[model samples]
Target: MRLRALLAERLVSRGLGETRDTRPQASRLPVLVPVGPQEDPVEAEADMRRRLHAVPAGTDLVLRTSGSSTGTGRLVAVSARSLLASARATHARLGAAGRWLLALPAHHVAGLQVLVRSVLAGTAPLVVDTSTGFRVPALADTLHRALRGRDPVYLSLVPTQLVRALQDEEATRALRQVDALLLGGAAASTALLSRARAAGIPVVTTYGASETAGGCVYDGLPLDGVEVALDAEDRVLLRGPVLASGYVGAEPGGGACDVGQDTRYHDVSLAGGTGQGIARQEGGTPLWRPGSRLPVTLRPGFHLLPTALPGELPAKGGTGTVRVLATPDRGRLEEGRLVVLGRADGLINTGGVKVDPGDVEDALTGIEGVAEACVVGVPDQEWGTVVAAAVVLQPGAALDGAAVRRCARELLEGSHAPKCVEVLDSLPLRGPGKVDRRAVQLLLSRS
Candidate 1:
């Protein structure tokens, strides 16, 4: 609390309130300890004095976060310029920027980007306090307030919040008022997306991490100045102005900028205008651009953990259409669009056959009585890791484990079938809308 107060003043004074790193620990501000609301004024001031001395004279804004893929934390020095570049690219893709309802926690990159966008748009974000907890009424109220203004309204949310919002009639109506509701954090199930679209919601699926300064790709296509490609291992690689400078105490490619070729960057333009295309392939996988080799030029973007590439690369000779082969969980690029498969880590291995939990979860959700489902790999002596499912049945609906297993087996391979099903009131969630996969596995383990 004391740290935010001290850092907030320093940032606002420098017009960096929307862009600077606010983590005192990463910044080495040991004096600014966490304080409650009732702390004495004198003590707070003394702490502030120490903090002022600790902060270097012309320090750049550095935000620190744990890598979503690797689970390792690092400090990222983000510049006001980089924030603006990211914001501009998003706005260019979304068409306009106006009043934004800040629903996410202010500490994370997703939440901070809302403020950054507001700053770039010369508007204040209508904040939805999550201290009490995220509720549909709170989101609706904040949206109502932001909509009263003439400027366009935007909202950001995780899948969990969207799910709750869809359940409430008032919240669903409020969502339609916004120009775009950016949905990311976790992959939204097909059932969830279908429900949102059915309700006339302008929900834009976003893909990006903290390294890229929030969502760089809206609905699979990279924003202006952003480029998305695949490495030989099929890992998604991003390059653009929004890319972070690099991790604070790391080597080259260790989450920071390049060491030797800092200034030399590839001038590859977005091959197709507006970065849109279509494709038709001989066998599902889009053929490599004819006679075109992966360029040696330096394109600046962070490498993502996902191993899916754009369906069609810029080929030597090609028309607007191309086709790309897709695996079960790793999505394929098709008709110039990237389809995201669920997390690769979530794949369940049973008896030497790999089963995508999402594929099984999709099947479970499609069942009449199942409201939601989360599948995890449970340790089994015979199969190595058997698939287990935690299911949440709809209100007033009853389902048996055998029925769910039978239905899944019908739709999926026998190895992909769940060995056990634990019906629960609700699946455990770690964040706003992310299912606690680890917790689900633990729950099934104990059961």
Candidate 2:
């Protein structure tokens, strides 16, 4: 199967599954897939056989961002501690350990995380081969058997997969039976999410990336021991046990926070905080937001974990204490939960003003006739770079290009409104569910 072909080397090297030895080996240096989204997986696996590969010591698994749709990628080294920290935090949030239904591509961070989480769960995950495309019947059959297990069953799926499943009554029924459906990999519309939740499906929208070992924040809340901070530019700066060591081959990142020092408890140099220590309310939980400054030197060991139950954590590797990994995504805190706006690099510069395309996309999708929208900056002599948009209208809905721009102006600032709007049958995708913004830029450039 494509899943095995893509992930066999990674899984076997990590010593996963009863099919393999599945034993933790301390001598094992970090097993790196190390290939970016656009690289060949077969070639990446071949790199595993080389005897001379080198990376920072204590690094466990090295993965890359599947920026396939965004036309970007980064290779990050995630230490053993960090991987487990991410897995354990997920368990703490989900409230139970069970079989994970792997629905995303195995090479992707979210799917790779299924392996990491399964190790802690002590239950082998049932994987679906997504390389051939998502089949609703396959999902139905798998969920049926998984639901029969003694332990609770969990499923991870992209929003596109969920959309497909929602269309088939059998698939929808099977999905409703799972523990919690993790919806991520791309942004889900408010209309789609509301419909899923309203249909008795427990849908949890996740926010995070490969740098954090996948989905560190769930449904707008940071996981246990994971802290979220915003840089001076309002870009998200992630810290704590879930953070990756840093990008592979990049120069050592300079941040205000230094980690792996002597501190079991979390200390703060955060933005929107009152005192030196993290402020606590009535429940004794520290308020993660409202810090005084956008400090990138934020270290780990933030939230207190639950007492060790049997198999509460993967009994492997060292502590994942490290400095902040600054993300390209722009975000803000609302009621202490992180609200990711869009990519910082994706901001459009027009007439000396920067506009967030994510904000524009949100406004566009909110319109009645628009089914999907992709926003990008198009080069223009007058404005220098004007906000341009490409949209896929709902089936049978005829939306005029001018009407689309008029609707956008009503919902957002003039600068945020699309100067050029193009209608398309569908947005080009670089991978499953993710929009190819760069391709959309090329398409919008022609308009």
Candidate 3:
């Protein structure tokens, strides 16, 4: 609430009239119209005004879920209090004093956070028009102009934007000038991260959502007062000061389930998991994992699991498979350092063994003629799903599928090798800069 009040005060102070009430809107296809000096602010304000006036004062703003890949709509309401808490937590995490270059859309939480952070940090964010799609050279030029005063600059971008920037010499140079480049909204590929680090970009990957006030966890670490724990099913659950008041339409559960309570349930079902369990109690219903259910006891304040599930427990102790449920794809904590593995969906399941495609992709990076390769699983009567790779060879480079398979065999295990290789000019990439497996399957089927 303090953070929301602070944001409202800041907006009002910055010439936004008190009559104008800022409200968050949720939509399956949320439109993010980038307004500039040339655009009509009166019209823009009118549109927002109409939306805010339509909803009652107590009504929460339901924003669409960040990723629409699953075709499931998750409406996350950003309360006035949660918005402010996020700003404060972000301010505390990322020290004050720095201008932010906003390339992300305001409709999404990450972009909204950048704008809010700018207001809370006492600096207005410089917006870049990515509506015409990302133009690395143009973006770099705008960023260079924005940094004319030698002021420290900060920017937030998804992995795709970062990868495109790295491919452009001008953009890459421009990125090196920034104080920090926060990457989130989706998982960044290992190839992309390695390239950024090599280019000397101060890149930081953030994890969180609109429910947690945006990026509560930066680079695998939680922000101040943010608590992280794995439920019995190994799904990540978060609590602490940064949590939203509650979703709009959802009942006001009670005191213990009120503001600052565990306010999120990340669906890890795709990776073979279930929901975090719940416990019934006076004044509140406790939510947790069912099997490893905690005692029907009340702890006055917030608590975090010291380590991730399957982390504290011995690896080989259980009879069932040692399924490692990672919240973020590709990263494993080894000796306290986060080593990313890419995305879980990107993993290739061959012969009943899981093969992280990233590892195979890394191995094939330096191979001759192979420009880009995406490993995926294809329906097989014998193997259920066998590893298949879609490869894009460099211009004028002759590609031999057999040679590529031989190369993979030399670098990876027999089960991990691509069982079938389909050569293409390019791979289908999604909005987040990840390989669009569905599109690839369609292309493969046609071929």
Pick the TM-score winner.
2
Q: Any residue pairs clashing in model 3, and if so which? A: 1-81, 3-84, 4-84, 26-62, 277-288, 279-286, 330-340, 330-341
Error of 1 at 299 (Å): 17
Local distance difference test, each candidate: 0.63, 0.67, 0.57
How does model 1 score by TM-score? 0.71
Query: Local error of candidate 1 at 124, Å?
Result: 1.2
- For 1-447, candidate 3 gives per-residue lDDT tens digits of 233344445444433313354443332222222333334879866755544322223223445443433333234445545555676777677676578877866655777677677765666677687667557776797789777855678888876577567767889988998888888866555666777889999898887665676777777776777655443332344665666433333322212133224423222111113223222223333333312333232222222221223212212333211111123233444443334455535566656798877667666655766666766667777887777777766556766777788888888888888777788665675433445766776655454
User: What RMSD does model 2 have?
Assistant: 8.4
List the candidates' TM-scores in order. Answer: 0.71, 0.74, 0.65
Model 2 lDDT vs. the true structure? 0.67
Q: Estimate the overall C-alpha local distance difference test score of candidate 3.
A: 0.57
Cα RMSD to native, each candidate?
10.1, 8.4, 10.9
Off by over 4 Å in 3: 1-60, 245-349, 357-375, 389-406, 421-447
Q: Lowest summed-lDDT stretch of 10 residues in model 1?
A: 320-329
Candidate 2, which segments miss by more than 4 Å at Cα? 1-30, 34-42, 45-54, 68-70, 135-137, 148-150, 167-169, 250-292, 295-322, 396-403
Q: In candidate 2, what residue range of length 10 has the lowest lDDT sum?
A: 301-310
Q: How far off is residue 85 in model 2, in Å? A: 1.7
Best-fitting candidate, scored by lDDT: 2
Candidate 1: tens digits of C-alpha lDDT, residues 236-310:
455566765554444334433231243222222233453534322223332233212222222223322111233
